[model samples]
Target: MSEGYQIRNQSAPHFLTFTVVDWVDVFTRKSCRDIVIESLKFCQKNKGMEIYGYVIMSNHIHMIIQSNDGNLSNLIKDFKSFVAKQILEEIESGGESRADWMLKRFEFAAQSNSRNSKYQFWRYGNHPEEVSSEKFLWTKLNYIHMNPVRAGIVNKASDYLYSSAANYVGGEGLIEFELPSNPIIDVLRKERFNFEIDEW
Candidate 1:
């Protein structure tokens, strides 16, 4: 992981990516995807996670998020830990047809990381990029929403059931999230009519 990608401002919003080990398409199964969704909901409710936007792809997830309690790194660490165990258990229970093959890969991935006891599901590093400016924020949000479209999984971003694009378009999303306001304007208002791009 590069130093630039490390989470610095723990309370600030960041664009994050969570990829499966070996880029495995674990989320092709709705059951697997649902586990991630429910886990994120749990974090939001109990861990002070504030999700700005997100999309779940076949092998990875992209999210715009922040920690309300200013402990983003710990919050993410716990989220990944819980979700990894739940999904591994689901696969071990024969919920997936490719369970054996997937488990072998996960086990192999775990061999390199001292943090794992049996399997490794998520890859190391979140690739977190702080949401530094209004332009950068919307750029990441657009990229997240357009993932399914770029992959041809959906013709329109809003048509994807596992993304916040639906909520962006005034439809309901599977998980709750806050619609982001322009960071520049929000900063300006909060600072009594003064704003610096870096202050975001």
Candidate 2:
């Protein structure tokens, strides 16, 4: 992780990535992925976090988001903290077959980082990139939505249940997105989506 790539505009939508420590396949379990979904929904409804798009992959999650309250960093910290704690609890409760192995890895990761006390579930730094232009916004959205397809997990982006592509295609994802205007995404919402997805 590099330094100085902070979220400059909390009110603006930014592309964010939260990768699991050591690129672990923690999200291969539906329960772990659901923990992320629950957290996103909580952020959207309670923390003023607006989710424009998102995807939960094996070892990482990507989101196109903004904080309506202009405290994006704080909101993200809380989300990560809560999800990490809950997932750690789940693993500790013994249903996870890889519990010992995963806990050891997370423990080692935490030992290397002064910020963490017990374990490090997600890697530090969300790698936020502010959405500066409509083209760039749409490009990132397309990239985020198409991730599972590129990874061979799904044939079409919209087919993935844990993604905002479902929202773009008129189906409901885990979180509701605030309608954005003055961007190509507006045209995308109007003409390109409507249950018929364009290949990006």
Candidate 3:
């Protein structure tokens, strides 16, 4: 398969989605979820990445992020590597004994590829969709918020605990979210896209 599209603008922010190997539901476990959260925090502190919005789903993660240090790729690469190592360590330490069957399943999937070290936690392609237009940005934001609702996990988007939906809904959340720039919002408005989505 062809590689996913990349938008490498050193000066502009971008939206990115990275999936787990074989679409594994890794985030179903709190340990796995915590690994991702810790990685994000580490990036925020050390990688010069400003995370605008994010949603941690069952097998993938979506984020509106940017790097001011001109190494967005490296930031993401390190973040993924760190999380994979931590999650693998947790698995090896018997932290998720109940997931022994799942661990075996992951091992089986990892065997299908020769590139991984031991077990592959995440896939290689980080299908990045650049948010150059306001309409697209708002659409992606709404999509991220509505993911839980679409998955039938929650009746309301804000009810999902692992996403930035609560941040948008005036509730306390794990990450501090900032509204996108006025120019971006204005462009979205001009395109006649509704930022406030009430239904799927």
Candidate 4:
């Protein structure tokens, strides 16, 4: 991996954007989205990853993640590997008839990379941006929440089913997420943010 793609300072929280190979809209398919969800749940159960926020877009995933054990890179690697294997298996079993086409497209993308094997589900670069400032954190948060809106998938961010917006908006049920400790929270308090579902 190039130095630019390496996850530096694993002890600190970071904002990560992972794109699918060739920017394919894989998450548009429910099966692909489920594979991601399952992989995330598996990480939460087994890894020391603390997922503060996330948004699952058609072609990529945006996340604010930190590792308690200082192994954030490993967590991301495992999550991607697990999801890729499951999705590939599903495709091989003919679970999704369209997967054959998708796999062929992914193979074409992998050919450009000598490092990849037969398939490359996600691009190699995770593009981890360390979140050392509060402003950057909020910027990343808004960017993630607005991704579905930018795609015209939903009028409101909280309406998107595959994001943590609902959780931040005081919704009862959704993907279980770990809220990170922010210095801003200490100054403003949770009431100041007033995360309401209708705010979107």
TM-score of each: 0.89, 0.89, 0.84, 0.86
- Could you tell me the lDDT of residue 84 within candidate 2? 91
lDDT (tens digit, per residue) of candidate 3 on 83-141: 88888788778777645766776677778889865677777677777778766777787
lDDT of each: 0.85, 0.84, 0.75, 0.78
Better of 2 and 3 by TM-score: 2
Score candidate 4 by lDDT. Answer: 0.78
Which is superior by TM-score, 2 or 4?
Answer: 2
Better of 2 and 3 by lDDT: 2
Please, what are the lDDT tens digits per residue for candidate 4 over residues 32-134? 8888877777777789777778889988999888887898888888888888888788778877767778899878887998978898888877889888888
Q: After superposition, how far is residue 130 of candidate 4 from its true place, in Å?
A: 0.6
What CA RMSD would you report for each candidate? 6.8, 3.2, 3.1, 3.4
Indicate the worst ten consecutive residues by lDDT in candidate 3.
191-200
Task: For candidate 2, list the clashing residue pairs, or say none.
Answer: none
lDDT tens readout by residue for model 2, 1-200: 35767887878889999999999898998999999998888887889888778899999999888898998888888999999999999899987999999999999999997988989898888889999888778778878988998899888788898888877766566667664554456566546554235542
* Residue lDDT tens for model 1, 79-113: 98998889988998987899999999999999997
C-alpha lDDT of candidate 1 relative to the true structure: 0.85
- Rank ordering of all candidates by lDDT, starting from the highest: 1, 2, 4, 3
Backbone Cα, N, C clashes tallied per candidate: 0, 0, 0, 0
